[model samples]
Target: MTYLLICCRLLLGVVFLVAVTGKLRGPAAFTAFVSSVRRMRVLPAALARPAATAVVAAEATIVAAAAVPVHAAGVLAFATAAALLTALTAGIVTSLARGGQEPCRCFGTADTPLGARHVARNAALAAVAGTGLLAGLLAAPTGAGPLAAPVDPALAAVAAAGGAVAGALIVMLDDIVALARPHR
Candidate 1:
């Protein structure tokens, strides 16, 4: 269960970090992407850029908070992860309901098309965060409780690297598959 928490934390942190980085790497591009989604009339036309900027900032903050010690950072990371998953789920549902097939800006320009994959990943992450929250609540009480447990040095290093790789791979999975398939 502990390992599961760690894995989930790392994965969420990595995803947020990468997403922020991608958006920040090209703020204008992200804004354009947001505009593209908005063009579908999902979001109010006036709120598009501001909303996109806010999401970028939120992702940045979540990534930073998620990187700290478990006792302090873990709880916040769990909350952030849950929030992100919820947002993504909402976006997925809205897009499906609107009968649009716009590309998800989650992975920025590097991502392929948007579809069930975004929803699926968000669902899995939300489950992980929910489990972590439940486990934390069930544990014994203390001033610190246990959100900021000292991360194992070796484990932390591995988790960081693995998280980055996994996130990148997940984001690129569709592109890779498309490239692999033989032309009709």
Candidate 2:
């Protein structure tokens, strides 16, 4: 369970870090993201910029909270991550139902339009966050200190490596699917 928690924490942290970086990469990138938000039509046109900014801030917060070694912080971070992903998923679903074809700005300037795959991705990530939250809560000890118990070095290394690989795969999922499709 400890190793599982470690893997989940690292995975969420890496994913959110990549996501936040993608949006904050430059003025042009963020502007594009705001444009994508408006195109999604998830909120009023006037609120697009603010919504985009809030999304990026939330991602950054998840990353920061995941980095904290405290048990309670881990639990809170996972909870926040789950909630954010759920909201994003709902937005995607709404956009799809409205027949919006705007490209997803999720992990930077990807030309992949919103689709079922995007919904599945967000759902899967939310599940991971939920699982991490459960693990953290279940592992808590009565009167535990601020910091979590130290994990075995080898286990920690393995968990971190696994999480990194998973994060990379998720970030590249659209490209992976594109490559797998039959070229006309």
lDDT of 2 at 102: 94
Model 1 TM: 0.79
Best by lDDT: 2
Per-residue alpha-carbon lDDT of model 2 for 39-76, expressed as tens digits? 99989999999989989998998999989878888898
For each candidate, the alpha-carbon lDDT, in order, equals 0.68, 0.90
Model 1, span 3-66: residue lDDT tens: 4456656776777877777776776768756875675456787877777777777777777776
Worst 10 residues of 2 by lDDT: 141-150
TM-scores, all models, native as reference: 0.79, 0.95
Prediction 2 TM-score vs. true: 0.95
- lDDT, model 2: 0.90
Extract clashing residue pairs from model 2.
none
lDDT of 2 at 27: 98
